[model samples]
Target: MRQNPERRTALLDAAIEVLAREGSRGLTLRAVDKEADVPIGTSSNYFASRDTLLTQAGARVYERLLPDEATVAQQMSSAVGTEGFVYLMREAMTRISGFRTGYLALLELRLEATRRPELREVLTKRVRADMDENVERHLASGLPGDAVSVRLLQLTLSWLILEQLTLPDIMTDEERDELVTEAVLRLSAPSKRE
Candidate 1:
């Protein structure tokens, strides 16, 4: 067995696809190995247990979808004021949609976490950290509101992402963008055109 982050990421990505398509029951270590098209025992070299694999896979899914440093920096430089905030929100939604399969696997992980207390706590802590980071970014970008506003913003975007991805045709892109823009404006509170 060799140590390779790329190999590890590939295995986790394979696991994500399995979880997304076949549900958790089918996500065996063998399935992950097969999914990655590697040797039969390759997954064992990376993950000690099925739960370990799944937990790491869940973390990987979120980790992969985080905003790229360059993009975040670019947004910070160019995106200011009400419209810029809307653009950043839109960018976030686009990222969510771009990683739809990974996000679906993430939802499966969330459900699985509920029955496993330790996993649940870990998931909660990680999710809260992500949220807190978003709030910090919002403030750094000079957007209005605090944690409450960020929560509302997250709720709004999550609902929009869920409905848009699952239902499809529930709302046109223009309509959805308008809804997101308005929600950001309301939650951000400064309203003045900057």
Candidate 2:
């Protein structure tokens, strides 16, 4: 069967929606086919296997989170010498929150990737790239080399955001903002070399 780009995109989009609405555990070929309005055999023809489809869907989610290089450069240029970094970070976090299912699905994929060497390598590379981009952005803001600290800060902030989503009313916007501020300050602190 010849690959149809439009149909493929539709299937992937449907996969994301299904995953988001139902979590990773709810994802199934038939569900995706129905969501995409495509025939069941169509998904199998394109994806070949459940793992392949899920992995591709996960990769698509990651790609969606990252700002294009042009957009990042533009934002960085305009953000110089201002609190724009905080704004940008908040916006990024907000986007992540919007794709909560994608985040949860990623968590599931991470575990699955552990035993699948090929998937593991792919996930590792993608994660490393994200971390490197984040570290580079932080460093460019004049923060010292503290990659580990920055990673910890990111993890903490992500946890808080995810928790807020899972337990709405557990945290107010003011509380989340305060936590973000504290984490950013800690991560942006100058290193001992300074």
Candidate 3:
């Protein structure tokens, strides 16, 4: 198997584009080759099968979707309290939505996972780990949120993102912004005194 890191990344990125544009049914080695502008058999050298390509493409989406160290440092330095928590969530939403193709590919991977036990196992573990990491980060950041709060906000914002991506006309920008703010405020609030 080819071990050239840069070439592998390029192939995986092309796979992501194909998955996003054509969904799982249309994803093929030839499609990825054309998308990557590589030779017909180039993708096969890096990926042993369509399942491997699909799995790697799913991993690549997370690689692209997660914020880099620099972005995380910047966000952490400026974020404080509930307001900062809201800001963080808004920024996260923006970052995730910005990678439209990556997120769309992720959606396809999720749907595809239903039938592929291997994909389901990998995706379930990855998503669970991501959620756990988010919970730990929220607790450490002094963001006025507990683990449940973080989990709740994650679930709600994900749906909002789906709406934004698939049906932009359903909600105006202001409405979405307000929803983000409200979700953070309500989810992260401390329990009332007995």
Q: Using Cα atoms with residue i matched to residue i, what is each candidate's TM-score against the true structure?
A: 0.90, 0.84, 0.96
- Error (Å) of candidate 1 at residue 61 is 0.7
Give one digit per residue, the lDDT tens place, for model 1 in 45-158: 998889988888888888878878897888878987888878888999988988888877887888889887766777888889988888888777776566677888997898
Enumerate residue pairs that collide in model 3: none
Candidate 1 stretches with Cα past 4 Å from truth are 190-194
What would you estimate as the lDDT of candidate 3? 0.91
| Ordered list by TM-score, greatest first | 3, 1, 2
Q: Sum up the clashes in candidate 2.
A: 0
What is the Å distance of residue 57 in model 2 from its true position? 0.9
lDDT of 3 by residue, 70-113 (tens): 98878987899888998999999999989999999999999999
- Residue pairs with clashing backbones, model 1: none
Q: What is the TM-score of candidate 1?
A: 0.90
Tens digits of per-residue lDDT for model 2, 56-122: 8878878776778898877767664325656666766777877776676676677668777766877
lDDT of each: 0.85, 0.74, 0.91
Identify the leading candidate in terms of lDDT: 3
Worst 10 residues of 1 by lDDT: 185-194
Give the C-alpha lDDT of model 1: 0.85
